[model samples]
Target chain A: MRMDKEVVNPIIDTILGSITSGLNSLQASMEPYLPELSWVAYLAFAIYVLIILAGGFMSILCRNLVRAMMGLVLTFLGVAGMYLLLASPFLAFMQLLIYVGAVCVLIFFAIMLTRNVSDGEEAHWPTLGALGYGLLALLAPLGVIGPLIIMHAGKIPVQVPVENPTGELGEGLLSDYVLPFELISIILLVAMAGAVYLAFRGFGPEKSKRHSK
Target chain B: MTTLTFFLLASLLLLAIGLAGLITRRTLVGMLISVELMLNGAGLSIVAAYKSTAASDVLGQLATLFVMGLAAAEATLVLAMILVVHRRFGKVTTKEISLLR
Candidate 1:
């Protein structure tokens, strides 16, 4: 009893056809879920935007230096949230750790140390007109450049498969970016030293005067 | 529309406001607050770029780490300086501190 070739070929073909059709339907059923995902993304984005704007406004309008620092913290938090939406959890964590935790704390301490809480004299310059002009100047260029860049971006070819980006980033930093990194470190060191020197300058004289008085 | 773009824009706005404050504020503490705002903006932009590119470069994360380290150092030093300045001048306003003349 030999099996005929024609019979086996049809059976194999039928089975393969059924499997392909099943996969196709499965994909079809999954398509409806994409919009929901997009909507969630949009909602997260809107919230982040609001956070950034509110923070910015607070930093600008608050007269008290401490209040301004609080606003800055809010801004940082909002930015970190945006980072999470962007899909880089590592960066978001860094933002929270550095900007909110360390930097803001430093600003708060600086405010406490320098500000005379009981003194009622204002600490800000009256530059409303100049500030408005500066704001307009900064925003106008961004507004123009943003649209132009967005329009041109569609025609630009996006580099695909960024070629082991993490590895490349490290290599690039150690190799190509080494000079800039070192320079930045030097600058930071200088800033640190300069600030210390400036702060210490009048300390001895001021102490003597206070004691003599 | 993209998450990265949105974040970048937000950071830019923050930076702009910070710059304005830094320029217009006359107190040492007010300047420090402006600096904090600027730093926050930079952090946000880095995170957004990392997230949208979908590339696991982790460079943005590393950069943020460095920024934090710098911020800590900066805060300690700046606060100490502010304390000393206040003690010497009896006031922290930038205008009042200009006694060199």
Candidate 2:
């Protein structure tokens, strides 16, 4: 009986451990390929970085609003790639889905809805007065904050990243972060409802006619 | 892979660009876009901090997720408000929003 129990326990352990064992074997198999893949990873990292900077500048500098939206899309894509490089593929996907998918679409709708508003002030290039304002806006934050970030960024100590980050993240959401998780859902619900109410309130032909006149 | 400094610097630049845009953008939608950019920078910095120094990876990720949620909420409210402004004021430029000025 004792011998039979011992044999059954080992069998059960093997069945339960097979998933991890498979992962270990897979990692072992890919060990040689990893060194060869390093260059590709570096190239991808560089491309993503360039994409981010270009998109940011394009969004900020472009005169046309639609063109600026395109730049925003580009930046979101680059940021998603950066998240993947940070070893969080889950966050990367979320970034793409939420930012590029939902938020951009919302902005597009807003742009289309308000496209007829012809404001000559906005259409003109920055004048001398506005140029000084723009310069102050650009330089003030950079001057005050840039040096502090530069001085301290290098001082941070990096460690070996956690294994199974995605799974752990899921667990933490349910366990440690249950409160905020629920709060987010509630906030999303309220925001959507409020947006719908605001949009449709007095949103009929009468309001349109008044605006048209 | 890139170092933490690179990510931090990237995030800082993003924030600066976003701030500049927010201050200078004449339209409500343009300002909203800049706000999104700023929020993205904040998320990147938070994750970078977590990736480098934090003991709990989940906390940083959770914060980023929360930021995303708040951003979505903010965008929805702001876009709706923009629509209302356009309907009421016939234009959406910051300069013409006389109540604010």
Candidate 3:
């Protein structure tokens, strides 16, 4: 009394097809509201933005240089998160890998080598009157430029449609921007050599002096 | 409500804070940290622009990769300079290294 294999196969196929159709219809119904998804995207963007700002504020306000570096690292991470929200996961990954992983380490090493972190002396370089003048000088440009930028904001076009921009970017870089790219590499190599030479110059004398001290 | 506006505001705030740090901080390392903050702010803006306009997978990413490379190279050079300054002066305080005057 067992059902034929052919009958069972048809029954299974029908069941699976019906389930798929149901899911497809559900997705189709949801398609009309796709633009609303931008709200969620906006929220994610806002949160990351806040994180970055907060980190920047901390970096500035903190008295300890090490704490300031930590804040900078946090800011970089927040920016990376924002990159992810912007749909540039590749940039986000590179941000983490290069800035957080390498640059921060270099900053820390420099801090360790250069500063006596435990020393409690103030590090201000300018007299109060000079600092006041400097602040005024700095603020003057912002006062002039800020309003101009704000007023012109409405006139600026904000949106540009990119067609598979990442792919196009690769093509553009390899094809059109190739020379600049190569030049950047050469500059980096020069910088690397210069840094090595500068760092090695007085290390021996300084180390011996420190040992004798 | 727009991601673009949100990101723009964030970058602006970041830039402002970094600028403040650069102006006020007396330690070379602190100024360097502030510069890093400013760079990150710039990078965020670029990524946001790419994401909104290009809607592409890799273009924004590639730009950021270049930024990262540049940041690394910059950091290495700056850190080396900082170390050299420290060795020559026996201190990294901005106050102590003003021999040019």
Q: After superposition, how far is residue A6 of candidate 3 from its true place, in Å?
A: 43
Interface RMSD of predicted model 3: 4.2
Write model 2 residue lDDT over B1-101, tens digit each, in one string.
22566677777778887888887778898888898998998998888778656557788888998998899999999999999888778888887778752
For candidate 3, give the lDDT of residue A69. Answer: 75
DockQ per candidate: 0.31, 0.43, 0.43
Where does candidate 3 stray beyond 4 Å? A1-37, A118-150, A153-170, A203-213, B54-64
> What are the per-residue Cα lDDT tens digits for candidate 3 across A15-53?
989987876676567655333343445457667777786
In order, the Cα lDDT scores of the candidates are 0.65, 0.79, 0.69
Interface RMSD of each: 4.7, 3.6, 4.2
Q: RMSD in angstroms, all models?
A: 12.1, 12.5, 9.6
Per-residue lDDT tens digits of candidate 2, residues A15-105? 8689658756765677653322344455676898899889987887777777788899999998888778777777888999999999999
Each model's TM-score for chain A is 0.62, 0.69, 0.64
On lDDT, the stronger of 2 and 3 is 2
Model 1 segments more than 4 A misplaced? A1-37, A116-131, A137-141, A152-213, B54-56, B98-101
TM-score of each: 0.67, 0.79, 0.73
Q: TM-score of predicted model 3?
A: 0.73
lDDT of 1 by residue, A94-166 (tens): 6777677767776766766655343433444457785776577457646865665445432322221122335
Estimate the lDDT of model 1. Answer: 0.65
